[model samples]
Structure formats: C-alpha cells, structure tokens
Target chain A: MSLQIPDDRTPDGKPESEQPQWRRDFPIDWPEDNYISRRDFTRFLVLTSFAFAVGQTWILAMGSMGRGEDRQGRELVASVDDIPEGGAKTFTIKGTKEPFLLVRMSENTFVAYGQKCTHLSCPLIPQPEMGRLYCPCHEGAFDLQTGHPMMGPPRRPLPRVRLEISGNKVYATGVEDHRL
Target chain B: MPVPEHLEFFIDPNRCIGCQACVQACAECDTHRGYSMIQLDYIARSESPQTVPIVCMHCESPTCAEVCPADAVKRTEDGVVQSARKPRCIACNNCVLACPFGVPKMETPMELMMKCDMCYDRTSVGKKPMCASVCPSQALFYGARDQIERQRPRSRPIHRFLFGRQIIVTKVHLMVPFESPVAPMDVIAAFRETVIGHVFGPNFSAETMVGGGK
Candidate 1:
C-alpha cells in the first residue's frame, strides 16, 4: 500500500514545502508555544492586578461614603401599651428591611435592639423570666438591659437600637452599632 | 528557615451536632452578603444523629479555579480559596461541578459562584472564621497547626487526601485519628457503622451525645 500524506497549509494558505525550513521542520514551534503560554500568563496577571486595583478603589469609595446612609432615624415601632411589662414585640425598621426587637423591661422602661444575634445573626427571642435575649440555636444569651452577650459562644453584644418615648409611643431612633 | 504560619482548619465530624450555628454564623460574614457558604450534612440520622460540616477545603491545586472558564475563582496569597469574582463570573457552573469537595454553589439569582473563603475578612486579621467562632462544639477548629495539635493530641491533622489515583493536598487540615492515614475514609466508615464507642469515647450513649435524643 502506498503511503498517503495529508495536505496541511499555513493560515496564509502556504503549502508545507513552500514554508521556511525552520517552520516546516518544527511545526509545533516549542519557542513560540512557550512565548504564547507566557504571554497568556502575563495577560492574566495584568488582568488580576487590574481587578484588585478596582476592588481596592471600590472599598475606598464605600468607606468614604460611610455606613450612615443606611441608618434610619426616629421611626415609630410600637406604642407603650402595645406590649405589657416583660413582653417583647418585633418590628421592622422604616425605609429598611432590618428587624428590631422592642422589649418592655418595666412599667416605664423599654429597650430595643437589632433582632439578630451578635454571634450568628440568629433571630433572638426575649426570655422575659430570665431577663435576657436568648438564641435558641446555641443557647447564646444576651442581657435584656444592655444587649451584652451573657452566655454561650457569642462574644459580641447585640446591636442596640436606640428608642425614644414620646407621650405613649415608642419610636426606634438611631442604633448603637457596638458589636461584641 | 522558620516554618510558614499555615493556619489550617480542622473539622471533627464526630463533634458536629448539626445545630446549624456554623451555617448561620457563616452568613454573618462581612463579605458573604448574608449568604451562608458552609453546609451541614447528616452523615447518618436513623441510627445516630451524626453530622458533617463541609466548607471549602482550599486545595493546594484547586480544581474549581482550574476549571473556571471565566477565570473567576481565585486563591489568595495565603492559600485561602476565594469566591468567584462577581464581574468576571459567567455563571457557567463549571467550578460548581468541578469542585471535588462540592463546596462551590451557583447563586442562581445573582448568577455568581459562591463558596467559603474561610472568612478571609476576619482570618486575615488573625481572627477565626465565623463558622469556627460560633460552633459551640469544637467541631470546627481553626488556628496554627502547633496550637491545634496540642489541644487535640489523639486526632492528627491531615492535609493530604487520595481520590482514586490522584493525591490532593489541601490547605485546610482535617482531623483524623492518630492511628489512621486514611482518616477521612476511616471516619466515614466508622460513622456509617455507628461505632460511636471507637470514634468518640467510652461514654457514647445517646444522652451523652450533643443534641442526641435520649
């Protein structure tokens, strides 16, 4: 049987025989292959560098803008009579989706805090009898008066939502962002 | 030269109670956007309520990064595997399917690949990952190799894993019994057989187990 060689040509349509000896002999072009690989790698590195720079710039911009823009000031959450002493009510902040808990500690005293637990963002339930906010998932407890982590794995205090009493209305105004 | 501080995470499946504290804490990660990257899976519930917490193992040669057509997945200089770059991610799910540990998940709504970055925001500052912080049980432990080794002497930290013929070296360490080289496999087998006496300790009753039904 006669040996048949398949016809292959360069991108320019030049026949194998018509090309330079180096090009014909070393069709794989190891040096060129290496160059292309290095080029791609360099390109990737440059792109990555650009991405990092952009990320840094974005972080800087966000930092400069400040987190205050998201804070809602003086939003009515509940009335004094809505919750009895030792009773708690959950309310969502106005103009935001954040949930806050309002607890009436005594006849005249009321406290409010961001509903999420400091340790894991678990919705905290107020244990009126224990005088604490408890995370059922891990039994993490926070002092009802201060929102300070009392027991369990939580190390940080719950974010205290500032409350204002006007006549009989309890308004959630500002928040103490102290994270324990 | 002094050994580099390669802080690896050690997960003890036997200690995981599946309370989902880690999952909740992971979502609270500053950069996670309230999305949890950690997963708690029940190894066996019928016989025993044993669970395993799965996070990004952060392999030395991460297959997720290698398979990403968009080059979105990245590994930090410290070897922690990061989530896909939101802008560059094409939501192809290549990394999701390529990950050996099944860590990466496609956030369909955002069309981005999300996975555990080992709470890099906190870890970079020398703080433990969120999952490790609120684990309650010492299932997820993150710290310097020497410190962790001292705390739990019986279980050795292992970074090498064998998948068929391929040997994968992970940046995150897995705690396995000191006597076994194939720790993960052995642990799984032990769990399947419900050999709590061997895995845990002598007091291996249901009442003794965390969150176990008596």
Candidate 2:
C-alpha cells in the first residue's frame, strides 16, 4: 500500500497560488505562519480614518444635494364630509405612511397635521376640548393650531400636511417643513 | 452664542412638559447631515413611566475627547466637542466609554462614532442650534456663557463673596421705631441705641462694608 500526496492546485481547476492580480500583493506581507502584517494593520487604521472622513464628506454632499421637493399641481384626498372636521385619516403618498388630522377651526376652514408623534413615532389622538393632539402611547400632545407640541413627550412640531381644496373635496398636496 | 466653560444644560423643569421637541430637532438635524446626534429611548425602568427626552450635556471637560486615541474628537472654540467627521473615526470605542453622560454612540457594521456638538456649526452661522430652535416651549436656550447665565432662572443662589476674608466690622445695625401701634418705642430706642452703639462698636463697620460691597 503506497501513500500519495496531491499538489497545490485548487479543486476548481486553477493553481492555488495563481489568484487574481489584486490578491497577489494582499495579506501584503504576511509572515510564513502569521496572517497579518504591521503595515497591513497601519493601512487598516488609515483606511478606517479615511472612511470616517468620507462619511462626513458624504454628509456635506447630501446636505448640499438640497431638499427633495417639487412645486406642482395638487392631489385629491378625502371629501369635506369624510373627515367630519375634527378627525384624522391615514394615507400613503410617495410610499410613506403619512397620517394627518383634518381640523375644522372654523365653519369653512380646515387645518391638517402629520399624525405621527415627533417623540417616538406614536400616533397622535385629537383632544378637541384641549385644542391639542394627544399620543396615547406616551401622553405626547401637540397644538392643533400650529402643530406645536402643547405638552407631553413630543418635541418637534408636527409637520404640517398641506391641504388644497378642490370644489367639494379636500386634498393633501404636500408638507411644509420648518426644520433646518 | 458661545457655550460656557462647564457644559451644563439649565433645564427649566417648570417649562418642561415632556414634549420631545429637542429630541425631534436633534434627530432631524442628524438625519439631514447623515449622522446621529440625538435619539429617543423608551426605558421601562418603571412599569408605566412616561418616556422623557435626553440629550448630550456637552460637559466642560469632555470625556469623549479625553479617551479618543486618534484625537479625532475635540472641543470646538465655542466649547462644543465635535467629531471631525464620520470618516475620521477609527471605530475605537474610547469616546463612548469616556463619555460620562453615555451620550455618544457607535453604530454597527462601520461602527462610526456619533454624538452632539451642540449644533455649533449651525450656531456659528447665526442660526439657533437644532434643538434650541425647534423647542416649542423655548425650554432650550443658546447664547454666550454670560447671557445664558443671566437668562437662567433668577432664583439660583449667589455663592460668591466679595473682597478678602480678613476684614472686620466694628459697627452694627439697629431696628427703627414706628409711630404706629404695631411698632414699639423700645424698637426706636433700641435702634438709636444700636446706631450710637455701632458708631462706637468694636469692629470697623464703615470700612468693612465699603470694601465688602464693591
């Protein structure tokens, strides 16, 4: 019984040492047994630093990309009678779940606010008596008039969902943001 | 306004209604810049306690800057400890560990460090910090150290004393007497006696009060 040894050819029909050129210099200068080099470690640290810097640069770039918006024609939403003045409706626009409240501050006027609480994504409930919107999950409250927080855990004002009137129908055309 | 030497936020508990305005403002600013400045945490330490807003206190001597080996973090001239940028970070958790407030965080995968700089950039440009600007209750304020100190609730105690401690007072004050029935003649007599007594008292009241005041 004779024992035979196999050569260093990879099972995939390629020489084990003949990988792509990019990999040739990699492991850069790994010693015979050790898997990494000091140079490689330093390079890794430098690259990490570069990555951090690049992340900031990316942020500046994104900020300079400007805000995403378009001034155009309006879109149709619920009818005037559908919301019943001091009520809310959840709808999706541009693939985002935007909940808005339709408040009848007067007989002929309507105000709407994004229903999501600014605190922790809780849904806001209307407190008509208090003229505020309350979040049951966290007791967060927002003013119905300016969408500012009246009390509780909400910090930012509710993004005012723009509403356009088309004859007998009320439409949410877009949102007006005060955030810088 | 420039931040002070010691970075302590004057939280007006009276003005705080638990509205997370500062939280959303911070998150928005962070999202705009593609970084995380502030985040809302819902801790259930008590079964039914309401979630409260928390933010970086921006300490005077920041632990984040102390522990950063790469020196990527630094306190700005305006007293904000700002990270150079996300790409400058080395993914070391030293800053996170050094922060006594535990406000700094490093996200997974890339593990980039992130924390608040008190919106120093925005403030330097004459805009209010994101949190202070977005506060619906005007709870958060930004200004020069002195201005903020002045704007702080007036009820805080004045802990400083004027002049040296070796001064002594030779005079004393006496109560004045009133003609009304609620007042007494002894009070007036005591006042006159004290007035005369203080003029001839053991300590130098006139000199001491003068230097002590101004």
Candidate 3:
C-alpha cells in the first residue's frame, strides 16, 4: 500500500507548480519530512518523557552500583616516614590517574587531600613555611590543618582523602563524599 | 584592508586557561579604584578544568543605558558602555535587572552600579583593554573584525544575536564555532548548553562566582 497521502489542493489554494521554492523543495509528502499529526506528536512527547524517566533510572542504578564498588577498595599510599615533618608527597589513587597530596604537618599529624586546587584545578603546592596549600595560578590558598580555604580565590575546602595509620604505614582508605 | 578605527574586542573560551590574570589586571584601571570588573567562571572544574571569562558585551542598543532612570550609564562614541556615573546614579538596579548577560553588579555600600567598560580610559587612546593585554592564554583578544576573523578561521566573531524576539547587535564580539548560516542565530540557545551552565549553575563554588572571595 502507498504511504503517500493525496494532495487535493489548488481548489482555491496556490497551484502545485506555482508554489513557493521552499514548498517545492520540501514537498508535502517528502519521505523524511518532520510533519506529524497531533496524536503522533502527543505520542512522541509521551515516549520522550518515558525515555527520560528510564535514563534517569538507569543513572540511579549505575550510581548505586558504583558506590558499592567504591566502598570495597583501600589502597596503601605511603609509609609513616615516607614524608618528613613539614613535607608533602604526591601519589595517584590505585585505579584513578588523579593525584592526591599527603602533608605531614608535624611529627604526629598527617593530612591528605586531592592535589587539584578547589578554585580551578591547578596543581596545589604545599607551603610548609606558611602552613597552607597554595595554588600559584590565582593565588588561592587553603589551610593545612583543615584543608579549608583561608585566603585568595578558592572557597571550597580541598576534597579530603580519608587516611588511616597503622604500624608505621599510611593507608588511603577512600575519598569522602562531601556532597552527602 | 585597513583596520577599522573602532576595533571590536573578542574572546575565545576554547583558549581560556582560568589563570585569572585578566581579573587581576582589570583592577589597574585608573577610575575603578581597585575594583576588577572581569569575571573568570569555571565551566566545570569538577569534570574538567575549563573556564570562560565574562565581560560587558557593549551592545549596540545597550539595555543598561536604556534602563538607567538617572541617565548614569553612557555609551562612548566608539561604543564602549561606561559604568553608572556616581553622581547621577540613583542606586536603582534597573540596569542590573535588565542586562540579559548578567554583567552588571550593584555595589550596595557605595550605592553605584558597576560593570565592565572595556577599559574606556585606555581604549579611547587606542590602547588594548587591561584584560585583553594581560590574558596569558590569549583568550581575551582585541583587534579589527577583519583581522581577527582572518587569523581565526575555525571560529567566527559574531556581534548580532537573536534572542527569542529581540535582535541585539553588540560592539564586543564573541568567537563562536563556525556553522552554516541557515536562519537567524540564537546566541542564548547556543550558550544554554555550555556557557550558561558555568555562569548560572547552582553548584558553582562561591569563589568561582565572585573572585577572591569578594
């Protein structure tokens, strides 16, 4: 059966031959035409709404699955004496290429955070003398103790990398989800 | 071809590196008194380290100038939109509310409307604006329209924009990726998927929104 609909115009309307160039180029029955009936448009809208729901559901499922996997892994980053007091060491996570910094603030205290500055993701430099993490790109500074922004542009605290110490070994447990 | 006497300033977001050199240099403008008008917005620093700088577009029919009840905002002969004059400014935020690009800010304590003037103090004398001069990444560039277009063929500098029903022609040009022209260009729709998110996103860190914690 032919899918093309018969055009019975030209009774009072413009004749087919005399129609505008745009109308001729894009014929009423063009195969790939975007035109659709009101019912079809409504149906397409409903399908689109359904598709968005399904996509969001899939994302939610994937996010939950990823979170479960995240809780299972713990990577050893450095030893207790690997970094001296008032020093910093940079290391990548086991599966991720992103680097994290470990700062030994004092003899007994060690803190770790994502090396990317909160301002613009420029690599941060630990200023041991000034007791802060500094980003040279924009003069962004973060407090060494709490990893909170203390000066310049950065407002968000550096994403803290959860750390555990046992028997002279420093273990990077997991990244804390600051959002939750 | 001779360069146009009134050269148009253009910015390419693709080249921006988020260094904030432009922001620091803007403070050096003689009249602004250490208040920088340039804003470096992090597009998606969490996902990627992309940034786009925001400055006054200097529209052909400036909404700021039109909305100013006290006749404080003025456009120069060369088309640079000046900030609200301190003496005549009524501290009414009509210009701030009317600006489609969200470029103006009301300094509450000072009771004055302030925004990017394209460094009129320097540009009037044929000098480059502070931001364009200091931008290390060359994201902010100032040159004649013909020269700039010739140098960067991949991107086209566009000043005319169609937003819904309004047609806005700007003095400052935005470098947009080349696309076949078939209809009136909607700059807002183009920005909606990219620049708008960075500028208007709720999750934007406070520092990125307002530089240096202010």
Candidate 4:
C-alpha cells in the first residue's frame, strides 16, 4: 500500500513566511545588540545588581577586617626633656611611616601634628618670623596655636597627633586625624 | 562692530592696593550652588604698580564666546558670559590666552575653563559685588556701564586721556611698522608716536612739560 503525503502538518508547525515579526528586528551584522526582551533584561539587571552588591560587600568586609579596636603596638619615641617648651620634634605613629610633628606647647603640656599641609601635602615648616607653620611648596601657612589656615593656599588644617609624656620620656600614642 | 554700551572695567592703578580681599569675599558670597567667582594672582614687578584683582567686565565682543567649540559659554541678555555646563574643554588655552585681561583660569580636578560671572546673584539682590563689598579702601564699584562714564570726568581724567590717546595711536602705529624688525612693535610705536605728536608741532614751545622743559 502507497503512503500519501499528509495534507496537514504536525502540531505546532507553522510556515516560515507566516512566522511572527518579533524576531525580524534582531538581525545579524547589527553593530550593538542593545535591544532585549523584558524578561531577559530584568534577569540581566538583577545579575548586575547582585554583582555590584557583592563588590560593595567585599569592600566593606575588607575595610572592617583591616581596622581593629584596642591597638597594642606602642613604642618609645623620644626623651621628653629633649623637646623644649614651644619647640617641636618629628616622629612616626600608627600605620604611617612618615614623620609627624610633636610640639611642646608648655612645660608640662604637649601637642602634635601630622606636619603635612592638606592643600598639597607639603611638609609644614615652623616659621618663627610669622609664628605659624609654613609650607614652602605653596606658601600655605597654618596657625601654630590653633592649626587653622592663617594665609597662603591651604584649605584644610594639619592632622593632629596624640602624645603622652611620662617623666623624662616621650611616647607617640596615636593620631587625632582632624580633617577639614 | 557696534558695541552694546561699550562695556569695559576701568581699573585705576594708583588706587589699587592688591590686598586680595576680593578673592576671599568672592569665595564666600559667590561660591555657592556649585559655582565660584574667579580668583586671580597679584603679580607686580618692582617698578610696576601693585596688582589688582579682576573679574569679567563682560566685553561687548567676548573672545571666549567666539572661540568656544561646544558653544558652552553663553551671554545673557544683560551681557554676562557664563558657562552653561561642564565643558569637555580641550584645554587648548585659546580663551585664556585670547583674553586681554587674563580673566579665565584653569580649574583643577577637571582642568576645565573658568572665569568670573559678574556676581549676577548679588547684583540682582540690590547688593554690590562681593569683591567691591570686601574692599577696605573702597576701590571697587559696580553699576550700569553708563554710570562709570559719568564718573570718569570727575574721578579719572588722566586715565581717560591716556586710554583715549592709546586707543587712537595704537591703530596708526600698527600701520607704520611693516617689516623693519628693528625693535618690538610696542616700543617703536610708543616712542615714535610720543616724539612725533608732542615734539614737532605748532605751539611746541608751549608744551615744555612734554620733554621735562618745565
């Protein structure tokens, strides 16, 4: 017996010419395929958000892991008697390898600064003529008394440091990190 | 070209003290809403008079407006040049160098073009410019361009005479010096113009003060 070709096609079969126009716009050789279906785009956006969230979370985790309370790395800096009243000395404290300023304001009182001008991070030198801390780089001057901008180009104050003196010795405890 | 009221800022060299109080005051009052009035340096040589602070006088024909590739610098109806948005300025320094008054400054962190805006906000509120307000010596003033004209006769006669003479002679001097290359154009022009105008004229004896005769 001869089997004749079926007049009706299989189920869900449609002719190529009768196919919907949805896929026609997405042709090959297009420069950038920016167009995407709503479902596909939503999924992609969700994935991008997840990636950003992961990156932010990783940064936060690294930051939290780096800083710890109760720092115990204390060291002897200099002799307290070596620093005269209204005089300053240089020392490093707390994670920074750069030197900082330690000024003995009075006989028993002491103050310290990072010795860097905030405008250009230039080394601040003491100007006895003007009675201010001067930056030779941009002529930025900060008040010796208050660490505020007295003249020149500095926009922020020098970062202050914390110090402790016991008997005839000096110790650099930590930094105040005063930002302006 | 016909100028709109011939806008120009007349600076008196003898009066200015170069305190830079204008710079600080401008920073305080005009520096808000993401804008800052321009600040300038005070560079005075030994013989020169003290340097004075400057702002945009809103020229009748702004060189900045002509050279802007993006058309970002715009002049308001009241004749003030302002930057509409953060320009993708090529850092060409064309406007900076083209300006005769040297008002345009290159801002950092972006290296975009910057200049004065004439304190439009403060002026609108019936207050003087921040620079004028902060001037301790009362050296600065702002008003209609015509107001300065009326005040010039009484306040600044020598300046007006020199400025007018310079305006007239500069054009004539530009023509005489073609390709000699003996000296610079400015010096030769100034010397020739001064000597020729005053030295050999009718009633030249009456002008004894021209050559220290008086």
Candidate 5:
C-alpha cells in the first residue's frame, strides 16, 4: 500500500493532500488510529443504524403515551484503542438529543457521561490536559473522575451512561433520561 | 538544490470550520483586485457541512503554466505561482481544466484567468497571505516548518500528493496523521474509497459484516 505514495517531492515543495471526506462529518480519528478492520467498519454501520431505528420506535411509542420511556439497549461507541488513557471521545446516541463523552481513566476503567452542562444543557468540552471537562458557555467545569460539577453555574452532577466492554469494542449500554 | 521559501501557507482540512473568513479576507486583499482567488469546497453538502479551502499548490512543474497556450501564467523565483498576466492571457480556460488541484478560475467578466498568488504583495514584504491571516480556526496557517510542527504534534504536514501516478509537489503543506505514509498520498484512490468502497463491501466473500466475527 505504501508503494502508491513516494517521498520524491524533495525539490519542488508539495502541497497538502485533502482530508478524507467522512472526516468532516464524523470528526473521529482515522480507522488506523482505532485499529479498525473491515469487519469493524461494517459493525459500526449496522449498529449505528440499529440504534437509530430503535430510537425512532421509542419516540413514536412515547409520543402517544403520558409517561416517559426509557431508551434501553447497547450501542457501540468506539474501540478500545480509539483514545489514549485520560483522553475522551464524544458521541451521540440514536433517538436522543444530548451528546455523551467517554473518558478512559486507566487501562481497564472507562467512564462515560452526558457532555451537556447541567445549568444550560450546553455541550461540555473535555479538556483532559486540564483534568476537567469545561463548558465555554458559562465557565462550567466537571471533574474527570466523578462527573461532579466542580465550579460555575451547573447545580447537578453530569448523568452517567452505563458502559460495557466486550473484546476490544466499547458499548454504551443505557442512558439516563436527560444527562447520560 | 533548495526550493523557494514561500512555505508558510499550511492547511489542516480537519481544523476548517467552513467560516469562509478566508474567502472574505482574500477578496479584500489589495492585490486580488477585489476578486477572491480562494475557493471553499464542500465534500458532501446535503450529508455533511464540512468544507475545505482551495488555493494554488504552486507545483514545481505547474501544469497550469505548461498547458497555457498563451504562456501568460508565471512562477515567481520565491515559488509563488501568479495568475495569468493581462497582456498574455487569452482566457482560453485550458489552465482551468489542466490544474490537478483545481485552483485556477476563469474570471468571466474580466476575460482572464486568476488563482491564488499567495498574496505576493504582503508575503514579499514579510507578511502572511490574506487567507492565512484571517482564517479563524487557523485552517490556513502560515508559519515556518518548526512553528507548524510545534502547533500540531499529533499530525504531520505533507506536501507531496499522488494524483494517479503523477506526483504533484506544491509549495504548501497539508497536515495529516503522523503515521501517514511518506509516499505522496494517492488522491484518486482515497476518493474512490470514500465514494465506493465505503458503501459496498468490496471483499464480501469471507469477512463478517457486523460484531467481531461470525
């Protein structure tokens, strides 16, 4: 595969190659970064579609009823190698509105929670370099370990999403009604 | 031998937020004569709002210059590929079709060919080009090699691109992941993968489509 690309641009100064098109929409690391095989790509698509289908059905079911409905089931969020320890990746569940962020704390422990600030439901940016998730909207911040509100206008702790790891794939099992 | 030093124009397509500040700023440059030389391209507009800015790659052997029948386009000593000059350009549109990077544009109203000149007026005076100057996300950053490397640690800047077998080297660089191949990236192959291979599993005989394995 490397044979296609040669480094012979030593004299004329070559311009940059365009980024992959999917990168613009997905905004995730390359398949190489995730160490994804062809099988994994298929799983990603199927699981994503399945999650979306289930979410749609849930919405239609709840629209006719008075009580709330629980968004149940597992969705593949990422592979284990997608992010290094202490780093985080944000993803959206099918049939849900809020985004969720997953943090890899150590070798075996990965924690996920809603990315929204409790104060205004603004998406919080994970700044692992600063050891806390920060919301630029109101200077709201949450601790990496506990998802507890550390400072600013947020009064409630960020909701946690239950996670299960199988093989090298990571799955988001269930989300709380609002936060997760 | 060392090439020209107008190496400051760097693009990180991933970092581009499609603000078009660069587009607005480029048209504002005094040298461009109120016409923006930069173009913003959307990958899949209906499906995605991602965009990347296009500027002259300033190829070492510029196809735009080679194919110009009137011989109007010129490459500066410092590696800037200037737009077709007024006296020589016939507005034939040959350069428009020949450029692999699709940087050149025909100004229909002016009856002339024009493209990014890296804002020679500002750069010659030791300043950044208009696009690089106003890019809000630093998608079009202008700096020395060391400066860019310091800013993007996880990514590597690449200047060589393989449009089929023709290796087109340019004055500017695109930042890609560090593990990317040293060989000029195969632009066409990547395009094919994005369009076809992703939609239909090419090797469907033995591979599992979902979960880990069958």
Candidate 6:
C-alpha cells in the first residue's frame, strides 16, 4: 500500500500493481438496517456474550503459552538532537504501521506517545507551545506530560510509548496501554 | 452562524449509483482524517440493489442532540450539527441509536460518537464537502437552491420528515419528485407498511394494522 497507514475500510491496494478495478470498493461486513426478529436479536446478544467468554479464554491460553516472550523489541526512533525542545518527530515501530510522536521537553526530559488520537483516531498534532497534543477532527486535546485528556471529547488518555535513551539515540521499548 | 447563507446540502437518493464514491472521498476529506461520515445503505438487498447515501440531516431539532445526556452534541447558530464533544461525550451510544438516519457511529476504539458535521471545517470556510464534490452522479449536492433547481428541474427539495406523530424539520434537504403540495415524509407509516407486508405478505391492508379490522 502506498499509504503507510490504512483507511477505515480495507484498501484494495491493487492500483500499484496495475490490476483491474473491482466494481465494489467498500464492502460492509455487517448488515445495516436489515430486519431481525426478536428471537434473532436475543440470539445475537447471547452469541456476543459467548464470544466475549471465548475471547477471555483464548487470551488466558495465549498468556500461558506466550509467557516470557519479548513481544516489543527495542527499535531505534531518533536521537536527542534530532527533535528540538518543544517539538516532536514522528516514527513507526517494527511490525506495526501506526505512527508515534516523540516530543523533547528539554535537553534531558523526553516523552513519546502513539500518534493516533484517543478519540476517532485522527492523527494527533503536537502542540508543544500549548503543552498539549491536539486532534483537529473533534478538537480533542491531551496533556504533553501525562497523555491524559485535557480538553474535548476524548475520554481516555493517549497511550504512552515507553522510551529508553542510550548514548545520543532514543529507542521505543513498548506502548504502555492506559486505555480503560 | 457557522454555515454561510445561500449554501445548502441536498441528497437525491435516486441518483445514487451505489458506487460509494461519496464514502471514499469523505474519508479523504481533510477534516475527518480517514473516517467517512456518510453511511451507504441498501433499501432492500433481497428485492433490489437500490442504495442511499445518508449524511447528517442537521435537523432543526436534532434527535441526536436531544437524546444526548452529556450534552455533547451541539448545533451551531448556522444549523450545522457537530460531532459529539470530546470531554463532554460519555460514549453512552444514545446519539447512535437516536439518530433517525442512522448517521452517528460509535467508534469502539475511541469511545466517541461521530457523524457528518457537513464538513463544518470546510463548509464554514465556504468549501463543498469532499463527498459532494466527488459524487459522479451528483446524488449528493452542495450548492444554492437556485442552482440545484436549474440542474434538476423535476426534483423538489424537502427538509421536513414525519416520524410517528413528531415532525422534524432539518437543515439539509432531500431532493424528491416535484409535486404541488410536498408533504413531510411519513417514515413510520412507510416502515410499518414494509414490515407488515413482509410478515403478512402482499394482501395486507393499512386499516387492519390500525384496528379497523377490514
């Protein structure tokens, strides 16, 4: 795909190869406005509940089997001097297409966060002068220091990306998922 | 007034080719990032392939805003109904369920209710929405009433809709067949007829549903 980031729907990703244009680009998986009987609605709810239970069981099994696995390997992001104080640089980690923002607070203090906003996932624009990250889509904002939402519709804090500085280089360790 | 005067949005379901160009262009709109606010719906998949593009009607009295417990949804003086406010929206999914057009969507990841704001960012600056701009069929139009009438002479724009006993007047207009006296569409009655017809087959009568026992 030309875009490092994919859109909401699945990208055809075919034009690059000069493939024939398929008639339908947007294919909705779920039914919209389709009629459902009372029995069907009840069955849907029951199935959803069972699916959640199965998901929990699967997670438990995966946790047991994947214990001690280093899922997030250290990936070099940028150097301290690369980003000026009160400015941010964007980068992506290995095996993930999502981007992250690394903002330099001072010569010593630096923080990183996932670029996607907590609300609606519009790419968050770093407003270092204002000491916050701003989402233009809904005017959502997050604190620069803690990633907690300071203003707008976003209810949860931006996921903080763990950073490790060694020598002149900064490395992204893993994302500290604080979404609750 | 956020939305400037003389400019309006029109939806003519008849012209929709089911190509989803509106949906594609909407996601590409600078305001929404990659999210498309327009919903493409089929009238009935079993019978025909007729499709409708549903944008926020931006009602005079928005049901989505009325049902919002957190007061997240806001309508400007210009009559543009905005997406739910971030800090204020509780993600209760009230707007999603309450919207007659099924416009507002609850993003599970973001826990926010988002819908078409008529591209308020663009529209406030006097630009057409991305969807309307790219529609090959002109099914979705954003322009003056005079221009639309000249182009689609047989089509009349209606902003009023009836749901059961309630009448909703919207900012956005739906281009319908031109008639002498355009009545507000009775969505509930039409829905009742469709549902009853499916259950009782073709021979069902409207009077029977109202306890006339014909």
**Top candidate (lDDT):** 6
lDDT of 6 at B151: 98
Off by over 4 Å in 6: A1-180, B180-182, B195-214
For every model in order, what is the iRMS? 19.0, 33.8, 24.5, 37.2, 15.8, 17.3
lDDT of 3 by residue, B1-214 (tens): 2123556689888899999999999989985778988888776556788889999987756677666666667655455677886767789999998887778889888999999987877877778889999988778999776787788889877666675566666766778788846244585674545443344543356776678331
Model 2: per-residue lDDT, tens digit, A79-156? 777766555566545545556667766556777877778888787777766788889987778888889887787777
| Model 5 regions lying over 4 Å from their true place | A1-180, B1-7, B190-214
What CAPRI grade goes to candidate 4?
Answer: incorrect
By TM-score, how accurate is candidate 1? 0.47
Native contacts matched by each model: 0.00, 0.00, 0.00, 0.00, 0.00, 0.00
Can you give the lDDT of residue B59 in candidate 6?
A: 71
Best by TM-score: 6
Candidate 4 error regions (>4 Å)? A1-180, B1-10, B31-44, B87-90, B144-153, B156-214
**CA lDDT, candidate 5, residue B94:** 99
Docking class of 1: incorrect
Candidate 3 C-alpha lDDT tens digits along A118-147: 777899999977989999999889988888
Instruction: Report how far off residue B79 is in candidate 2 (Å).
Output: 1.9
Q: List candidate 3 stretches off by more than 4 Å.
A: A1-180, B1-6, B180-187, B190-214
Docking verdict class for candidate 5 = incorrect
DockQ of each: 0.01, 0.00, 0.00, 0.00, 0.01, 0.01
Evaluate candidate 3 and give its CAPRI docking class based on DockQ.
incorrect
Residues B28-145, model 1: lDDT tens digits? 9997989999888765455678888999987766778767776567666566668987767899999887776779989999999999988888888878899998989879998777
**Tens digit per residue, CA lDDT, model 6, B96-208:** 98787779988767888888988878899899988899999999999998999999999899877777666677778899888646578865564555442134534467877
Question: What is the overall TM-score of model 3 with all chains considered together?
Answer: 0.47
